[model samples]
Target: MKIYIEDIAKYEGQTITLQAWLYNKRSSGKLHFLQLRDGTGEIQAVVFKGNVSDEVFELSDKITQESSVEVTGTVKKHDRSKIGYEIDATDVKVIGESVDYPITPKEHGTHFLMEHRHLWLRSLRQKAILRIRHRIIKSVRDFFDNKGFTLVDAPIFTPNACEGTTNLFKVDYFDENAYLTQSGQLYMEAAAMAVGKAYCFGPTFRAEKSKTRRHLTEFWMVEPEVAFFDIYDDMDLAEEFVEYIVQEVVKHNREDLEVLERDISKLENIKRPFPRISYDEAIEILKKKGNDTEWGADFGGDEETLISEEFDKPVMIHHYPMAIKAFYMKQEGDKAACVDMIAPEGYGEIIGGGQREEDIEKLKAKIKEQGLPEEVFNWYLDVRRYGSCKHAGFGLGIERTVAWICGLHHVRETIPFPRLMDRLKP
Candidate 1:
């Protein structure tokens, strides 16, 4: 019977055929040990000299790394094996041979590996990270779907920038100039009013020149917008949302986490009511820690790292200066009524959200103050003029969140294909 590596445990002590690729191979005199992977999982296939025909042994000897082969062997439990199962091969069929594979067991430079990312994804580490990413995406949809948030997809080509005009990737829409969307928050707000609660999960583009480990020119974001939800409610929702993703990844992707060598304890400690502090308080903490960050200045990567180090779980920093925030954020006298959630262990900010401006005149004034084209925002202003309520939402960077969960140092590895400041190709 034909079986997969992952299902080998069920057919223990029974001969089965596995059509897989030779991941790696080593031989000792007359015995050969072939590492085979079939995408689902990997297993060790052993070929004994006297037990198999000369043709089978000869075929096994000629098998190179990453060669496609059909292996017929008896499955057996081997506690010594990394995957806890192995196959004693009685027959071997060479389907296809791959020679001169670029990626080897030895270490390679980051640029070299990234340049060969198409082939590099077949590596074990990349496989684990991609699996974790899949689980994260599934958990995101499940969490929002269970909460009754309609999946409203926002457009990729937007008329105006939601974050800022400077970091927009300009494109020509017919005769008019259009820009790639920085966020779906504005459209999601409109959807929320129409559907009560709405979320958009799609790619967002930015033309930032930053080459930091956290910055990506193109990345996926999941934004949830809810009408009648206050800033505090938004923070609470953020905490719950983050905790849910972390816990789900931990529970479902435990083996992948083990493969990545991530410390599961850190993820387990993530709970609700995450450490909450005001932006002023964060600045003070940074000052006490001898950082040079000033009160109204936007926090940089290093500043965010310093602040996140204070808490074991994700931390919430609220009420930033109005001058530094987006123009449409609801203002509380002198400050923007918004919040930024910083992930633990120097993951930086994974979420940014706040209450949106509900007053039509104040929204118009802020839009004008930000020097945004009023004609473009006329549709947004219609939300307030029609029947805007206390609305709140947040955008979670999918790559950053996956990196944090997988305990990765760079966000580039979290996505299958990454678009960075200096990287646009495979």
Candidate 2:
């Protein structure tokens, strides 16, 4: 009775019971053709007036789209069927009936579909995107787990801001103020010192007001921190990690990829040893491309795309100016302070990481130079004061990565329930 929709293909010449919802139906006088879907797949059921009882025939005629039903049918091979299988229904029992579904099998506007995202997710394309997202999440944990990286959970509520308070979502935590975490890198750094290597994967929040296809107020980020690692080692790990995730999705979700209409050739070219470029070199390349960018400023979205276009695989741009990077990033001599590596092919900075300053005196001076309260980060500074080793880490946005791999224009379609700056619902 609880058979999957996919199992109907092998049940030829036998009576089977299926519980599903009516996806579509066509009636020709006394004959009826019904399409049933149960999440996994869809199957066509043919009901004839003369082959079944009057009650069953009438029930099949009255069923509407999305009406939940239980049907008893005999399976038969049909050459005309789209899936090479058909069911001849002897009985039909309607369990639930929807009043009037808004979504039909026709084209609809993006705003309309996003407004009705709850019901829109029942469509095939949305289902495939969510499934691929799940695969990416699984692959992330699997890669870190196999590499002996401990899974450390960072607190959603924190006392101090990792970057700054400008774009942080502030919340009232009892009497004090707490903000939603923007990245798990800081907390994972301490854990990495304790556990040798650690990674944290969870939802992060940002109060950015930008309405871009690539931006989200609430997104998932996976941050991996390692002690005794330098910027070069960090870049190497980032490339290999990204390559593994892409390979896993390609290996396991080929059919889902096809449903999403992704060009697998682009992802096939994504592998380890992504092209690495320094901040100075990227500036030179951008200058040649007629981009009005300076050496110290961070790369704009368009500039990042242009630089990534020059390489076949993902590109890593490292050693950014200290003033342009986070306060915690270690300064490289007198030229630059931090390093950042970006993915090529228009992925746009999939990995943001750098070497952290481990010296207590240097970190204290840098915190003051950034005009941040040292008391707020006293605990963070304790790591450097007591026993700290050279450490490096990076945060990879899960939605952006999935959108790039699946070739989706908008990041919202990649997640089942996307929480944007203005929209937050089913």
Best candidate, lDDT: 1
Compute the lDDT for candidate 1: 0.92
Clashing pairs in 1: none
TM-scores of the candidates are 0.98, 0.96
- Give lDDT tens digits, candidate 1, residues 52-116: 99989988998888889998889988999987889999999989989899998899999999999
Give stretches of model 1 more than 4 Å off. none
Worst 10 residues of 2 by lDDT: 334-343
The parts of candidate 2 lying over 4 Å away from their true place are 80-82, 335-341
Error of 2 at 69 (Å): 1.7
In order, the Cα lDDT scores of the candidates are 0.92, 0.86
lDDT of 2 by residue, 1-426 (tens): 468877877788999988888989999999999989888888888899999999899988989889898888899999988668888989899989976889998899998999999998888888888888999999999999999999999999988888864589899999999999998888988898899899999999999897998898999999999999988888888888999999999998888899889888888888777888888899999999999897678788899898988998888888877777777888777544345555656767777887888888888887888889999899898888778899988889998898888888889888878888889876
Model 2, C-alpha of 404: deviation from truth (Å): 0.8
The lDDT, on a scale of 0 to 1, for candidate 2 is 0.86
In candidate 1, how many clashes are counted?
0
Each model's total of backbone clashes: 0, 3
